[model samples]
Target: MKNSKVFLSLCAVLFILPSLDAQTKRIKRPKSRVGVGSVDRFVQESFDLYDKVYKYDGYAAAGTPLDDDDIDVLEEALEEMTVLSESAPDIIDDLDGVGVLKQGKATLQMNKAKKALKYSIKTAKELLLGQREREAQENEDDTAETESGDSPDISGTSGNQKDGADVEAEEEPSNISDKLEVYSKFDFVPGDKLLYFDDFSQDFIGDFPSKWNTNGTGEVVTVGSVEGKWFELKGGYGIQFLPLLSEALPEEYTIEFDLLAVVDTKTSSTARLNLTLADNNEFRDGPNKSSVELPLGQFGAFSIRVFNRINGGTVINSSLNANLRQAVLNKPHISVAVNKRRFRLWVNQKKYVDIPQFIAPDKALSHIKFNLLGMRDGVDRLFITNLKVAEGGVDLRRKLMAEGRISTNGILFDSGSANIQPRSLGIVRQISQVLMQDQSIKLNIIGHTDSDGPDEANLALSKARANAVKEALVTIYKISEERLTTEGKGESEPVGDNTTADGKAQNRRVEFVKI
Candidate 1:
């Protein structure tokens, strides 16, 4: 009976294989753009293989025993995926050399496919091993029962043990400290003095933020699994969202924010979120402005545009094709640094745009304006939080060496938590560099917080945050733990008023003091 069931399953697989092959053949290849078409087809086929392997892994993990036939099919799929992943780099190189596709476009997809293949292979192997072990044990039990002329015990002790092991593995939490090594090359240093900071914690849910102005509708809302409140801006052609600033922006400053987009890629292909630095903080676009327009959801190929208009005339109109589709859908940190005519931008840890003469040095870029274009009214959504602006050009190393103490609000953390924000690593990196250069420097790290929560809880959070910073230095930067000590003053040490947003931003700072 088992043999007949296996034969039927194999026959069913054989019938489905032809249909899959036919579907692959139906994909039309562009004759005029052979290289581009080949890449697109390759990516599609790789994803299809990945989906199959993922499903097979799920079946195996759900305690469903994969028979020999099923194992054979999974092995074949894994081999094909492995070949595709191994050939990706060479394929990307050839296409890039031919100028058939934009640089990094194919490479991005290749990297993603390779990563997926790696995890899928690992999962499939573990599941297959478990299945084989169970099969071997069952055979042994059958042999014993036949030899002793007794019925075998079928209480499923082995199966329960396997399920319990899987449960334990699933319950293990991932360590963020282990992931910080990837940011060793990250060099985005935030400005020294924070001019403005807002995580939308001060605003009520479903209400417009008091410190912001917008022509279109927007509300502060909390997103699932994301920390703090976010301002969700409605989509339209001429809609504009502006933060109310007391004074015009300086020539040198940095801006950082967290962005999340939830939209159907097919429908939101043409949607764009524009970050504009203009002369005024109003709903209307200023005459002189420099804008960074990012596409919301184009999965295949997309471009980031930087447009500059000075003296009522457009000067800089540049675009670079980048693979930011996945990053946009996931929560991505956006960082921008402006120094005179030079402008630079980073999405997460990767720097996407850097122009030497992008901004107009003559005009005062006072306001940061946000505008959404080409999105559906109710279907698409965009949210942004932790919007921070700070003055640039402070040399942290020099300041620390000369003054013996340096205070900075740039080392940010999660709301009411000790988890350090990844972007805040830039500031910590600089401090690490200073320590590396001078091993004799023993310093004390102090954490402070705004008076929003209870004193006892705030104090504990502050101490935990200070300890987190110390751990990052020791673990990630390999700094000596003996050279560092941590303390938290909490709301006891107040550098700014607790009533105002800017004041709260100032008060919540980390200070490195030489001891």
Candidate 2:
């Protein structure tokens, strides 16, 4: 009887298994019918136009009337923006931006689109105004010609052409002569030491990344013409992904990553991406004790939402409104600087959000995750790479005194060149100020590079770079040349992994050692 009962139970399970499988099959997600080809073409065209306009030397083309090609480019961009903004049917001008939100709010994407449209409209108007002005001038000239029997040459401009050409030539140097000049205004500087860095280079393509934990699996996929592998999020329900870090983030650290939003014709109409940083290591454990949400979309406006149980149960919410369409279409670099409760974030090169008190005074982020929360089907693609976390908020003088050396990724250089970028002036000035205060102090300037290309070449480059720094210190800051010595480490020492971009960037650095 016992044997019979056991056999019967096994038979029942086997019999029900097929039905369960059938039910699962019935509930399986349907493949998207809209192809990626249309999306690809749109992306390509948008990028091409943006790149051309962004790199165009407006100074060089000064006083030149809008040509047919220029008008066509602007028109194409205008048409695309119209389609993109209008693709979603429930399009309401709710001054507050796009996507699912606690309240109607504008997003970076929405603002960016609106700004682009505004520019196009303005350009179109300007073009028309210029045409009208030119026509009127022509008519006046024609009347003058009819009366005076002399027509001003179209090729000549009452000596204005020579003046314009001279002005154009002068402006050209400001644009090309110093590529690093703009960087002087870019105040962001990397942290003192590397904490955690990953570019996903070690992870095999098409497989779930080995170093990340996801409630639902995510594959490491490569995009066309894009370098490195990125984790792609795909599932019906939301997925949470966190790096395999042993401990929580430090009190003062910086985090940066590149984000790419993939849009398809089906999904681009109403796409949304939600990311959150929480104290909980795993979301599957239970409800979040504390968390901060960043929802990006609704035409590219992004909001920061925070909820903490420990810190007075206070909820803080804010939004950074700007034009960020290009940031979505292309890869946008996200940089977050955290100094305990204070948080500052930058998208691309623009500082959109700055919160002196971002989190509770007692709490810090333990893990960061990606989610497709409340997102509609179709626009569910995102690519991430070059993640870097480093300790910041350092006291330079204290560190130098304690360690007898100070290394910085601050002193930057042009790629493959020994020329120090102007952006390094801030750090350079700081160092010079310190030296000037202490005339007895002597220092050694060292240069290092990542293991890229050939070792001999890197060694040569490093030496040249070190010497260049020594020269800059002497000439620019008036630092004593006798007090400074130069050396090159090449790839002999590395604080980070060479295989990853973040690691490579960390490795290529300069150091000041007290001698």
Q: How close is candidate 2 to the true structure, as a TM-score?
A: 0.56
Task: Pick out the ten consecutive residues of candidate 1 with the lowest summed lDDT.
Answer: 21-30
| Structural similarity to truth (TM-score) of each candidate | 0.67, 0.56
Which portions of model 2 show Cα errors greater than 4 Å?
1-177, 264-272, 284-312, 374-380, 395-404, 409-444, 464-486, 495-506
RMSD of each: 12.1, 22.8
Residue 432 accuracy (lDDT) in model 2: 69
State, as a TM-score between 0 and 1, how close model 1 is to the true structure.
0.67
lDDT of 2 by residue, 155-178 (tens): 112211222132111111112112
**Steric clashes per prediction:** 0, 16
- Candidate 2's clash total is 16
